[model samples]
Target: MSIVKIVEQALKDGYLTSAMEAEVGRICNAASELSIEEYMALDRLMGALLTGEVVVLPRKQFINVMEELVLAEAIAKVAEIEATSEQNLDVGDIAAYALNRLPPLYATTEEGANFQRARAKEELQEFISKQVKEAIAQSLNKPEFFPERQALGTSSKEEVISQVSNLLQAYAPEFEPQNDQGTSSS
Candidate 1:
């Protein structure tokens, strides 16, 4: 007989007394409560991880399969949220954020030096780009007339504005090559 049938027969034969049934229910309830607590802890941990508030050791330094499992669970949560939510969600961004926060899983000899270097490079590029854009805007917003602008045949404010727009579009294609105003390019 199947396990389910055997269990049914035992229960029907009064093998599982009222006390035993009550105890089983209590145990199941306790287990359900414990599982809820475990899930909550995991959710908090994953949020901390994705938000860069927590760190996990790399596989080389500390081989903890639980870390991987937690990450997997976090990813699964994001995926579930994305699938169910009406609004669009960026699962890739969540994955990237979690991965960036976690230590290097494959290469441990370098101690995440390469990852740090890449992030630094990206930050530096962003900073420099911001500075350059701000400088351009400030220069263009000046009231004073510029001989250089005149020489470039863009002495008029309209010409300067157009040039700025063009430069912005080239620097950031998300600005839309055709749209001069700040609006959704998509």
Candidate 2:
């Protein structure tokens, strides 16, 4: 949807969802220059946001406690290994590998998170350690097939903007800029 449509929806709903925010950011980044209408819509959105008429929802409302457990295990092991030898393991890779193999423990509240953490410690501590060890071993042995490959879910705003711009250009081949007269320019 266009920026104007998204703004209208947010106004009607009294909330700006993360997806809507991302979409607006994508559209704004994709366009070479904002039209008057688009600018006006953005202004309205800004005003509404400032006035608390449209609330912006957080990107994530829950946490996966398992990720924390795995990361802690991985970091400890990596630190120990790095301390002894010249080998510097990627803690992120180890944590990600272990996390993928383990079940997620999602919690929306602190109490729930503490409960899950305690449960995992009681039941899955050994398993979590084993997974982290296996992940470290695999990471050590795995060849750097794509050393240049960037990690997922870690894109900066500039990178996201560029990606959105590229996607728009690739997908919307027929899209044209609107001239000041409100007519599409060839």
Candidate 3:
């Protein structure tokens, strides 16, 4: 959605989601310049946020204990391999692979998280280790396909600007820039 649309939605709902905030940030960062409408929308959002008219939701209120366990195991194993050799492993990839194969232990409170962590260590350490090892092996054996692919939460500047421009055109067609011929640029 365009910044105006997102702001309108947030105003209507009285809540600004983390995703919405991130999208706005991404668009603002990507754009070389913001339109007058975009600036007004952002200003309104800021005022609403400051006055408590809109609440920004927290990105995550719970934690998965299994992810921490798998990450710790993966880092230790990857460190061992990297220490003795020149090979470097993607710890995030390894952890994600293992996490997908394991059950989640979610906790909303610190005490709950501690209990979940202890329970996992006592009952699932071996399984977590095995999964991490398998993930490492698979990563090692996997060929380097799509080597140019960007990592998560990233995009080319041109791509981001194009997306923002398209959104602006769709929501407010009159905002499009005109050439000397008095026609909008494509």
Candidate 4:
């Protein structure tokens, strides 16, 4: 079978990778007897395949091929920037391409955006935890809430303070205090 047919079949089966595409193009080019019309026709076929209408769960082999293809392209972009005499390489375009070529797991823009949001949430949680710890430490020395605590039980100040800290930690696991050695009290 011709390289074009192989590419078409691989694409239809959802197993085509960028590396395979480039290799197939090279093979097609080597066949000098192919007319301009033939090349253009192949281009059209490839273009149709990229229309995003066809969604399939890609095979593991294809997934591996895609990772290598994207990584190589990203590395090449970095190398090109390094080789250029101009120092102010924006690199934004390459970064965008690399991000767009991420795995099938991040197939849509929403998936990528959601992943970023999750990372931001984790960072926000950490920041809030630090703030809560500081607030708890300062409040530990205060007597403002001691009157209310006495009405509940015969607990001493130390016990009351520990209980308050525990309650705070229960509400926010990230706020769980560190021990003397700076590890979590878990």
Better of 1 and 2 by TM-score: 2
lDDT of 3 by residue, 102-155 (tens): 999998777787788779878998999999999999999999897786645446
Whole-model Cα lDDT of every candidate shown, in order: 0.41, 0.81, 0.80, 0.45
Off by over 4 Å in 3: 81-90, 137-186
Candidate with top TM-score is 2
RMSD for each of the candidates: 24.5, 17.9, 18.7, 25.0
Q: How far is 91's C-alpha from truth in model 4 (Å)? A: 32
The TM-score of candidate 1 is 0.19
By TM-score rank, best first, the candidates go 2, 3, 4, 1
Please report, as a residue range, the 10-residue window in candidate 3 with the lowest summed lDDT: 169-178
- Give the Å error, residue 107, model 3: 2.6
The lDDT, on a scale of 0 to 1, for candidate 2 is 0.81
Kindly list the per-residue Cα lDDT of model 4 for residues 37-66, writing each as its tens digit.
657656655665677533333533211222
Deviation of model 1 at 168, angstroms: 3.2
- Candidate 2 residue lDDT tens string, 116-168: 87798789989999999999999989999987766565445456436435544
My TM-score estimates for the predictions, one after another, are 0.19, 0.67, 0.64, 0.24
Model 1 agreement with the true structure over 105-180: per-residue lDDT tens digits: 3323334434443453345434433433343334335565544534245546566447544543443333222244
lDDT (C-alpha) at residue 168 in model 4: 39
Error of 2 at 62 (Å): 1.1
Cα lDDT for residue 23, model 4?
64
| TM-score, prediction 2 | 0.67
